[model samples]
Target chain A: MNTATAPAGPGRGPATHDIRNQIVVAATEHFSHYGYEKTTVSDLAKAIGFSKAYVYKFFESKQAIGEAICSNCLAQLEQEIGQALEGVEQPAERMRKLFKASTEAHQRLLSQDRKLYEIAQSAAAEHWPSVLAYEDRLRALLQHLLLQGRDSGDFERKTPLDEATDAIYLVLRPYLNPLLLPHSLDHNDQAPTLLCSLVLRSLSP
Target chain B: MNTATAPAGPGRGPATHDIRNQIVVAATEHFSHYGYEKTTVSDLAKAIGFSKAYVYKFFESKQAIGEAICSNCLAQLEQEIGQALEGVEQPAERMRKLFKASTEAHQRLLSQDRKLYEIAQSAAAEHWPSVLAYEDRLRALLQHLLLQGRDSGDFERKTPLDEATDAIYLVLRPYLNPLLLPHSLDHNDQAPTLLCSLVLRSLSP
Candidate 1:
């Protein structure tokens, strides 16, 4: 067995990093196709052409791999939302695009891989710190947008910033919740647009 | 044994009606003090000094009794909300009072009897038709309020009436969800008031 393929701490050579990334990619594929309950560590290792022991060297257990997948997905979502807001000077326009981008991204991801969506749901329901932290970041992003709207005179300053943030988050939950999006799509394809308009109108100057 | 005490069909004497009401009251107490899983037909029968067979005649099963309790609670809540809206001509004031009355009534009942709340949660999760019907009624009430607001020029008619109704309901979920209100109360006692103001502002002309 090649010693370079073995897992090592951070700052190790690129060989270890590559191997860890390979494991995660393979694990994600297996999880998406086979679901969490059915996908075992051995299956992930086999997909990556590594031993089960080699997989364990990097991730403590199957659950850790699932967490890593969820963390990566959330990070990617955060980045996508950030990119969507770029080049939009108006706060109202930015808010509209933000909602559109966020909802579309979530709906697209869930539709592509239902098992991955289930893992995300489980992580949220279990109150995983990583997922919780991501939620806080999302809320902060909305709060910043609301502040921008107020400063730009696009939104009236009737409600306090914090209260407005909570209100928007609560109102947009149906659009943001992946589990509910499919149902919403079936019920009304234009739900995201409708909700976005309502949210903006709520903040009208 | 008193033949009059036996369960009878509708329009049987007033005595039969009284006994049925008595059974429902006793079952509600048992289900409240003890959880749904622990409360049995025998226990209810014991509480009301009736045989288990007699209890079964009145209610097909323990679940039937729970359903009756939930139906009764929802009816009382509906009446209270109706009363709260009485003599309030201003749309904003009516909306405010409606939210306060609804939230307070739910919180009060859940605090008084947690078991009933749990049953309600189960009913929602299971998609019991009775609970679904109640939800429809609640949404209709809000829709009526929103229509009145729009007609009175208190609210701008930007979005369709149905969409606005949905937006308000989604935003107020935290206040209206029985399982969530207790936790929200623990986190912030003033959430209902804050949400109400935000909702009304969203509808302002």
Candidate 2:
């Protein structure tokens, strides 16, 4: 298979990254649809018009590919949450923004990036170590923000930060499951706003 | 197999409903140890020293047996929650009790009825209509309580009851996952309580 054209004035720079990204996206779709047990490296390679050898050139193994894709999905989620809370001064406002950003990202995963969500959930169930590490990372970020809120006197929590973070993640659990979405969820953009408002009501000082 | 003396009856005077309670306890242990996919009617019969025919006398199928077990579990949960909220006039106080009761029930499920918890979670994911119906029933109960709190002017302005109930369910999702509790989760329990408290605090007038 041939490469999909390199970047202009660059020595095969963007194409390399683009091809890897494409492979990651294709792999995510395969894992989500067929589940991790059924998805194969060959299937992922075929989807992106690349030979097995070419796919291997980017990813050392299927596990490696999964790690890369999972990390990317999580990193993007972390960024979205951070951006949502950015520049919000009020504790309550920050809390609202935090939930809105997180839920919107979750909704996007259910719709546009359905595969990523499926992959993440399935991975967490079957692949314990990697998923646990990912969970820890996410939890740490949440813990930091919660502590910040508490220090700023925005939050009046008595519980430890880790437990509080767990609470936030648990509350958002249903939103992560694709099966629980309303029939109108796809058309409804107000989900994040409504979810954020309610969550804020739950946590406001 | 022979019957287990039929609760000291005279030559078998048709085992009473209380005897049925004994069968349920035995069945719970069997299901918890063997899981839904592996446990069988014959096994349960052997465990209780009752013939398969005798076991069939009370329940129609393994599925029927499962339904009975789950119904009992939910009933116990409802009772505990009610007891926790007993004599609690204020909404916030009621919420604190509710969280404590729910956590206790959750802990019991983790330690004593793990098999049923696994079955219920899988059932929920697999779209078992009964599981969904039970969950809806729970949501309705929570909504009723929220309405009562609102009517009493104890709760502050918040989102609609149905949506808030969904948020509460989401917070409880982790304990429902068997994998998350392969070992005791006494430490993890703090998060959901804190989350519940935060939300309740937000709603306090």
Compute DockQ for each candidate against the true complex: 0.27, 0.25
Pairs clashing within candidate 1: none
- In the range A58-118, model 2's lDDT, one tens digit per residue, is 7766777777777777678778878777787776676667666766776777666554555
Highest DockQ: give the candidate number: 1
lDDT of 1: 0.76
Which residue pairs clash within candidate 2? A202-B198, A202-B199
In terms of lDDT, the poorest run of 10 residues in model 1 chain B is B179-188
Give the per-residue lDDT of model 2 (tens digit) for B109-154: 7676656676665554454556556656666766677777888998
lDDT of 1 at B106: 81
lDDT against the true structure, per candidate, is 0.76, 0.64
Candidate 1 chain A: worst 10 consecutive residues by lDDT?
Answer: A179-188
> What is the TM-score of each predicted model, taking all chains together?
0.74, 0.63
- In candidate 1, position B86 carries an lDDT of 93
- Candidate 1 differs from the real structure by a C-alpha RMSD in angstroms, to one decimal, of 6.1
State the DockQ, from 0 to 1, for candidate 1: 0.27
